[model samples]
Target: MSRYFPHPAYAEDQPLARTILITHVGTRAITTGTIIGAGIFGTREALRRLRKAAAPSTVTASRSQLYLRVAGHSTLWTIGIVSLGLAGRMWGREEIEWQDRSWRLMENEAQLQTDDWTYGGMVAGLAATALFKRPVGWVAAVGSVGAGSVAGTLGYLGWRYGLQRREPPISE
Candidate 1:
């Protein structure tokens, strides 16, 4: 993935600590993968359905570049751009301040949790969508993202909140 970073003098500081990049970059890669992996499988299923519905079924239609735009695959592309930004910020030397580092670390962990929940929901949604060996589309696809996110996000929030609010139990 290509990124555009201005001359060093123009920017204040880099996002990641230069020395600690190995761990953070790996985490960033895994987080981005989680996000992409969730959406890509569903997009594949969607493509199969669109193809099957085309005339002379079983004979595949020529793949169209614009099919992605028509079928809402651009969501993945947008997320890909965001992921690149996350990856690119690790390159420069200056480190984020302690306060900012704390905040960013918390945000990264929270996002990791959310990514897990969301990916699980995405899997279940894809499984539930297939009926008669064909995908159930339209509202169903949209609902997959929506309903799963709601339930999974709620569960994740509860777990994270509890962990943050209460101390670990002592084992005597």
Candidate 2:
């Protein structure tokens, strides 16, 4: 028999699948952008604290005080938010897969969704860094913003799709 190409499997509900994918990617992009903006602010504060801590007057301060001064409230908050956001990303993976399965999504489609989310997030984060005079605070701001977005998006998706079962589109 002559070799033949295999037919591709399509999602049962193409519209639903597309919606979920688009929503995921869009949420990631917006979240990333927001976080980057926050990062700009945090980066600026961190730099200022760094500069102040390095001054001669603060040189004689105790180790703990020096550390506190270097990592002020804003800096600490930024660090915490970013850390949590990253952790949230890891936590949301299972939920993402669940949604994919619920919608009977194709592998390629899922992968594409993930890739877009990642790339968008990266670009947003970096762009924020560049927009704010190239300050280093973007690291924290982006992280916090990203973290907030992840939590918000995942919660929304899980609640909307996972909690309520919807019928897949009827194939003609």
Candidate 3:
């Protein structure tokens, strides 16, 4: 039965009818808005903090120490982005699951899993760098985490919805 028109037997069952009312277009709109909103606010806050914490350039005691400092900064950046991404992911998943139970829910769950793996991998990279004391510059280290987030988001969207090459799942 259509969610908009509940089965006659469950005509008065309001919750069941409400459970799957978010259409594909509605889901896409909500997800897109959520991502944009979260990204904007998160980036704003990060930038504000960075500006407030700007330090005067000074020669490092040694190249290794400079590398370690950059690695530490990058680790912190990774943690922040991962935390923000996870928070947004959870919020988006909850919203979708509340209004969808089929393909949308499945896709959201998969996206969340992808985010989890990406974030975890970034943390593991930081750990390895710390352990090995490997030299890495700020841009490469920080940009990598940012790239992971972009990749995860785009990868699934492109795979599932790109080019509209296949039909979307039918909604009941």
Candidate 4:
């Protein structure tokens, strides 16, 4: 009997799907790591704040309040992680277009350079946000990350185009 579905080798050749899968996995991993790291670092302070603010009538009440706060925070983190994962998956589609159009290559010096800049920008933004605290800080942090990614993309495009222009034409 003939098979109804294409061979597994055909699926393996689809770079776009592979890129999206990798991006989704990477986003989830990063989000999970960040959530865990934050919990480990800030749980004590968070619990303390909850206790102080609630001024519960009894020990059990305070404990319950703490549990609620933790649960709420965990829920928020989970939502954020899922949102980021979805966004990453969507972004991967644009990346696949860039790859298909020869705008960027998966494993190349230009791509590496662009990634470095993008990550550096994100780190810098997050650091600024953490240091400044609230209101203006969050906005600035987001702006910085956006600016950084745009700058990196533009730089990569310029480099690619410049290299192309500099190449000598082949003689027939």
Off by over 4 Å in 1: 1-74, 93-116, 136-151, 158-172
Question: Per-residue alpha-carbon lDDT of model 3 for 1-172, expressed as tens digits?
Answer: 1222333322232344233333322333322433444455456557868889653357543433443444345445545565566456545464435434433333444534444444554454444444434455654344334334444456655665675455454556
CA lDDT, candidate 2, residue 50:
82
lDDT of each: 0.44, 0.45, 0.43, 0.44
Candidate 4 lDDT over 1-172, as tens digits, reads 0011122233323345444344434433433433443464367667869788754466543332343334334434654677676567556465545333222233334444555554554465445435433333333334434334444445555665765554323434
Best-first order by TM-score: 1, 4, 2, 3
1 against 2, candidate with superior TM-score: 1
Tens-digit lDDT string for candidate 2 (1-172): 0011121354342334334544444444545554454456567658979887554564554433332233333344554566566456555465545345535434433334444444444455444434433234533444433544444545545544677554334654
How well is each residue in 1-172 modelled by candidate 1, as lDDT tens digits?
Answer: 0011111321234433332334334333433443444466467668868888544456332232122222233334434565567557644523544224433433454555655675565566545445324443453444444334445656777777765664334444
| Per-prediction TM-score | 0.33, 0.28, 0.27, 0.30
CA displacement after TM-score superposition, residue 43 of candidate 2 (Å)? 1.1
| lDDT over C-alpha atoms for residue 74 of model 4 | 48
Q: Which ten residues in a row have the lowest lDDT in candidate 4?
A: 1-10
* Position 113, candidate 4: lDDT: 55
